[model samples]
Target: MNATETFDWAAAGESLAESVTLIAGGARGTGRTAALSLLQLGARVAIVDLDPGRIATVAEDFAEYGTDRVFTAVADCTVREDVQAAAAATAEHFGKLTHCVYSAGAYRAQRPTLDIGADEWDLIVDSNLKGAFLTYQAVIPHLQRAGGGALVSISSLAGRTSSPFLGCHYTAAKAGILGLTRHLAKEFGPSNIRANAVCPGGVVGTRMNDLLSELHREQDLVELAKQTPLGRNVHEPDVVGAILFLLSDLSRFVTGATIDVNGGILTI
Candidate 1:
């Protein structure tokens, strides 16, 4: 390579048509959006979610892409065997696994530190942190077999700072994701696999919003938008863009890093 030679950044950023990506918690929300974006870029995607109903619904919508390009699996991310099976199935169907995203998580009604019970903590931790661990463990070997891959896990703004909208369990689980991502990045870089986390602020019109609405704590969109420096709340697309970048060659050298997708909130 000479100084006169320029990197083909645009081509580098494009997802390969032969690429296969597996996404957990991809039935809806940010995960679904990212899966769609990757598919649009010509990558085959295998989406896994615990809810068979949700998977069916999303599959109905994805069927237009044809079965060769879209695959669906029913698996619980918290269960190691389930995650392992999902990974195996994905690789079997696609013939290779080139990328993975652990985007499955949940946020229930806020509970004070003292008021939160062991059950609540267990549920959140199992879903958010342990789930990510299992997904990472199950997928990395396949990625190594494929020579290399990219991984991005969805975290949250509350993970980085205290938030009025999130509970203790939710914050702790998301924070745990940051540590998990960094460790994987460090341990797997030699294998040519990169790992990163995306921390998104308040994102409306997501299943999280549905949870908030059920808790009677869903705030006015306009009010929440005003609080953001960008003058709008982050949406699924906003987060998906960052996720895609990290999962693409565009961020080949970026690993163990937490990219904020918040609307200029908590710029640390």
Candidate 2:
């Protein structure tokens, strides 16, 4: 109301303290990294993943954050019941849900476009796209109970562009994630909930590396970096940082947006 009024950025960012974040696929890669970052930002975190053993290890590693601040549940993102149970468990454990990140995805070995079978297509789509839908389906009610929250979906640069390395099924599924994320933001904005997607390009430390290893293209990172204007591929922290901004009050006004974490490889 005054021309001399000043905005308090630091005060505005204090919203992360004591908030609760639930991350699907939080046992490894970008998901795990994001969960850890949220802990550092003073948020309690709940990890949902398929492997109980790996979840145990992650929980052990996060012990420094205190057992009371970390929780885990076994869930297959593609399975509706599993996802629902994971969401309910997380909400019950935390008593309030404030943020969510769905980073679970399936990227099988690359095959020729013509050779991709229906089974392969369904597996990838269900895990990447439909899984996002189910996670939102399960988590939104809990998030609403907390008066609104932020949700981020992990997409890929391949989803935004034609991929020379990934299969058609993977590319299509990832692309669908962006569309799905936008719909969530539009539909939930009125409820004070925010949703966005992060599109990472050639991330070096994520499950994408496993795909390269399977294709015997593990050595491509060095060459790929040279093609980027930044002379490097994105690492785990790069994508994690983007997700943190979207999840926190820092991006309170941002929603339905795709934040690219590439090393300047593609700009759109």
Clash pairs, candidate 2, are: none
Worst-scoring 10-residue span by lDDT in model 1: 1-10
TM-score of 1: 0.95
- RMSD vs true structure, all candidates: 1.8, 2.0
How do the residues 100-200 of candidate 1 rate in per-residue lDDT, one tens digit apiece?
A: 89989766666788988898889888899999999989999999999999889998998899657658899999999999999999999999999999999
Q: For each candidate, what is the lDDT?
A: 0.88, 0.87
Query: For candidate 2, what is the lDDT?
Result: 0.87
Candidate 2, residues 1-268, lDDT tens digits: the string is: 2334585678557677767888999999899999888888788999999888979999889988886799988899889999889888888887888888999887777669898889988988898889889988999999899999999999999889957777888889888988988899999999889999999987777566777887788878888898999888889999998998898777888999999888888897
Error of 1 at 117 (Å): 1.5
